[model samples]
Target chain A: MAEERQQGHKWTMIVDLDKCTGCQACVVACHAENNVPSPSEDEIIRGRANHWIRIERYWEGEYPNVKARFLPVFCQQCGNAPCEPVCPVYASYHSVEENLNVQVYNRCVGTRYCGNNCPYRVRIFNFWAPHFDPPLEQQLNPDVTVRGPGVMEKCTFCIQRIRRAREQANVEGRPLEDGEVQPACVQSCPTDALIFGDKWDENSRVAKMIPHERQFKLLEHLGTEPAVYYLKGGETHVGE
Target chain B: MRRLASLSLRQRLILGVAVVGAGALLVALLAIVIAQTSAADEQPLAFSHKTHAQNGIQCQFCHTGVAKGPVAGIPSVEKCMGCHTYIATDSPEIQKLQGYWERQEPIPWKRVNIQPSYVYFNHSSHVAAGVSCGSCHGAVAEMTVAKPVVEMNMGFCLDCHAEQENKDALWDCTVCHR
Candidate 1:
């Protein structure tokens, strides 16, 4: 049984960067939750750190009028995903069930085509076998697989946890409840900047939030139709 | 008849040598199997699972992190000393534990349960789903040492999930893979 499909459910997230403190909690939480390999010190220095969701810092205006804007960017799971078509193997594909982009590691062969084709530069390649120092290795989340070298990996919206939560509810003979299966980034966000849920359900938070006046998608002109939405910054501090 | 039998002396020697070699090989194989099986059961130190369980020490006491995190971590020496400092001061085992704690060195407990690197098994999810530690670990409360009772194979895991009657958990390749 496919488990009564939450009919017309399209998962989505709306990140309000104005509320985002740029604390990087979502980034760290994503790393721990997804089991993304930690790059070595040298890799960090080379700007090769594997961050599925990163807060991109941008400087605007001159000194007195200067302001910093941080945007958290990850796999948009675009309806017309640029990364999907370039993949030689069908490693990257959009799921019909949740309208989520799923990255299957086993199916992936080391093709850099997807990485080069991505506009946001979110996709990262594994150059060497990921190693965790001794006891630190024990800290890895058993729910997520530790990827090895020569494979490409990006965000999966913490699909493993979602599957677990849904299965547990089904086994108990109940419907999937709201706030039951939250992505690690959503759970760990101290400022509550990230909201995730089924976009198709009119009652869902994500569905309700998407229509806000400030909402906009990254590179909307390209018509990528990313599931993720962002709220533009307000004019409260525009001149100060 | 005597001439004919004496002419095949080389054949008799070859047959005799082949029989001896086969016998030796059989003995070696038997010894190797016995040694390997015995090693699996041997404990690094005497540990009574029965006593700990009976004393009301929850499985999470020693195997921490089963609730809020992925790993059900093995207890560090300091965690043991939190109670053992007064509980078993005279025992040689306690003395060893204390020595390690004094030096601030964690005890290198040999892991009895191991899965392949490709697979991801979260203790928190299982524990949250009401799966007892005993379900997979066996009757740890009755044993003196931990031995793997269930083979931690992909098929073994799939079989357990299948019994749950939840298709959501059963067939997803990404459930265990990244």
Candidate 2:
């Protein structure tokens, strides 16, 4: 029983805001990897687009001397997740093995309570039945389920990839190596903006980068203790 | 319709009972057919596991992916022809298999047992964990045609997983759900 209580690796992601260009590569990669359907133009206009990750751009300084700051935001995978408890059906819960928030699509009754409770506003409710046109259906990832209508989903930090990595590691009779599991967002980031690894591992890139002076959680004061950390962006700004 | 309406209340009651009885009988017959179909779906070739097992062939020889991947893969037509080339050239099933190989068309064998798409069941993990094929698949060696011996459901899976020493990882929903 005590062995079961032991928390394994703390999977964390450190996003270097300085490196982000708001290119939306990570966003596109996420949609492709997770089988998230692209919403219709009208649906997107109505704010029904299901982007697991999105670049939040903020304008700095006056219009004449304006600087664009890109902040890529997704599910933070909080240690004390607000969404977990609010899920009436226990669909949105933290996995003990993975140390990440998991959303069981089959169990979710779509109360949207988890989406509402999320401070990061990462949980997305499936407002309509997903439509994949023609050849697009063939590209759906078999590892990840194509979530149906009336289910709440969010960025899982690519839990399917994590599971695959772990299974391979388990079969090989070795502990999971650092940087072994790369999420779709991390893999697609052209500027190396998203860094993902086990923070518990002292040698991991995330562990080494996590102690930077600019490092801050999304909502530190709210006490969410999010796994994702962002580096402050002002230092790299030109023409200061 | 008018003649039926003109019948006595007692006669009408008897007619109603007779119609209900016939409907129930028809439903029962349909259910039996469905149950049989699910147990052993129609296969292109009537492959018998008993004959193969009795001939000293191992299950792993045909199902090469059973211990390696998520699925216990169906053997290719080439794999079948490898043995059928010299073993049983006269057999009708062997001839049918040869026809598929000649045409280079895959035999669309209907799966007898299948889990829901949502459930991420891995054959390798279970095999590595020392689960016998018969545990979930029943005694295929004795079965002439493949049939679902056990219901592949959450409760059926949990029954064995609960017995394992490490309950945390096994019990976690994401272990199978995600």
Candidate 3:
């Protein structure tokens, strides 16, 4: 289902589930780079935890030969996002240039409509004030905002890094080259399970990888065209 | 409902008046805070931009980082001594500069323009876009003690950003808020 992409860049990500070790380097990298709030151990179960990208673990089969399947779920940057139209405040909108779904922090009034309408359940509400303990507070990334309570936030695909890379490319009087802008997750992947690039460019890796037999979009039947593409693992049922 | 019923009309009136009065007081105090945040905070040495600018000294001469980075960095004491060594040795300001240089200390220059903690401003990007210092700071060459002549508010920034000629693709909230 290849279609013509929008001008400038159509950003996309490809995650090979087969190669994922689930070491969660991407998780730690995202936390460090994006200033995800650190809720205390007790607050975590109370629905006050914050994670822009979360690894969903689904256990398969009984305990004898059980296996945990990990799915790293974040905002899909959907082409027809359910979250967008539901936002009465117009805080959640799409960025055409990068094919990104961005949240306007100041404009968001914490209505939680966008969160409710999201099918992927990627949107996490700030149930309480975001915090970082003593020394961790000093480690907050200056490039990313420590979003206040009463705002619903999700993964922006590291918009700060994208803007910076674009600025540099513009200053140099050249188009952004392939593999130029790596999101925090893509950069930290030890197994190179994740790849990010402008799908508009024919030569880009993501564009080339899109049509592979193993490639699939999460909830494709729902018709929400996600920027993220995942590859199925080669494993089969234990008795099969 | 029961709690309100327990109070007489006079008591309610007094409470209403107090709420409005407190609200107004709070608003007034916020205005003062905002005013002083951008107020031409008195620098330690009372450096005059008017005199230096009139003498054909560029804004970049002292604020070297303006064109290349996030901050328009303040001039080091050594930079002042670089010219004050020969130019104005007898002047009081020059003597002050000399003293800081001898002490090997940096001059803690008060900022004329202030950005809130939430705002992420890039000086290099603005400079590259051909924006003049006066566009935001007002006429730097004309000011004696440089204060924030322009109100650096979100609306102020968005107006410039959404302009037809200056319309950048980066009107995204994360562009500035982060």
Candidate 4:
């Protein structure tokens, strides 16, 4: 089905690494949008944490020349998703129409096999039930469910937003226009680092960015065909 | 279980039967209590759908957000009083409505029917598709208290969705249960 849509829209995300300021606005926006739950400080220390999108910080250079680099890691929505087939219950799979990785939360039996199989390591296991500190519960977006414990959850490319957009578009009897359905990360990126659009549309920003000589997938050598693309950093050093 | 090893075979069989019988009885009683509590029969006012429908009132007139938002919003106290202030000043129901209006306090209506958290049923989408209030809701025009006429389970949803005309965009698990 993705191949059939070769001339049609293929949902893809392009992240311009050069544009990322490491502000982690995208990460915070994702948590706010997706009800991904906040584990307590002790749980975070125990290596139990929940962030659908996490900014991986790396320090480069030495002796005052050191600079922290940020790479926001989320579900790549791989074309050949390694996390799909290994799912004993088919909870995580690719959507033919969306051309994006889809997770059926209710179907997930929490086998954690998908977590083990994901090459991106973006998949996370909900070790315990999610708890909200009083008023924080009011801030939750009702469109997304507060996933219960014992279910493996991860970035769905903010599929709830996509679903709403698509449904609205259908009701209006029109094909999705360019820049219509933005995943939470893309929408909240203050630096314009994340651009989500149909890659098949030649005029779309993602299509234009995908061909840049510096563009690369996280684990291209693994042949996972990650839907997320990254633009190589500029020659200038960050935090200078 | 290990302590029961010392008991005779006959005695062990009897214990197993007794434990199973008690468990079944407990389960049955729990089901009844759950059913009774969740019937959606009681409301702050004796709001009768039959009377409203007979008086030519549309469901959307009260539940204003049914076609625009996720929730089919309950009518506000002010919305109720807007008509009742002049129309039914002598009626007991109107008096109750006026009491709330005078106090400016919202009624705490008990929740009636709702899908599990997993099922993300959007009211706008269904309403826009021209599905009637009486579709999943049954013959609501004939009912007084809005008790659930259908179980409204996955099977119930699937049965209607399985029809050819209403089949599109309905099958996927992500379609409903996000």
**Most accurate candidate by lDDT:** 2
Ranking by TM-score: 2, 4, 3, 1
lDDT tens string, model 3, B37-105? 755566778778899999999989888987766678887777887888899788887888888889888
Give the 10-residue window scoring lowest on summed lDDT in candidate 2 chain A. A1-10
Q: Per-residue lDDT for B30-84 in model 1, tens only?
A: 9998876556466545667788888888888788778655578877777888998
Per-prediction DockQ? 0.16, 0.65, 0.42, 0.45
* TM-score of chain A considered alone, across all candidate predictions: 0.91, 0.94, 0.94, 0.93
Clash counts for all predictions:
0, 0, 0, 0
Worst ten in a row by lDDT for model 3 chain A: A231-240
lDDT of 4 by residue, B1-178 (tens): 6889999999999999999999999999999998867757768888888998999999999999888766889899988888888987899987988888899889877777868887888788778788888888888889888878788999998887778463644765667765
How far residue A72's Cα lies from its native spot in candidate 2, in Å, is 0.8
The structural similarity of chain B in model 1 to the true chain B, as TM-score, is 0.75
Per-prediction TM-score, please? 0.62, 0.90, 0.87, 0.88
Model 3 - which docking category? acceptable
Candidate 4, A37-114: lDDT as tens digits: 777799879877778888888888997898777888899999898999999888897776667777888889999988
lDDT comparing candidate 2 with the true structure? 0.88
- On a 0 to 1 TM-score scale, where does candidate 4 land against the true structure? 0.88
True contacts kept of 1: 0.26
Clashing pairs in 3: none
Judge the docking of candidate 1 as incorrect, acceptable, medium or high.
incorrect
Give model 2's DockQ, 2 decimals: 0.65
Q: State the lDDT at A152 in candidate 4.
A: 89
lDDT of each: 0.78, 0.88, 0.82, 0.82
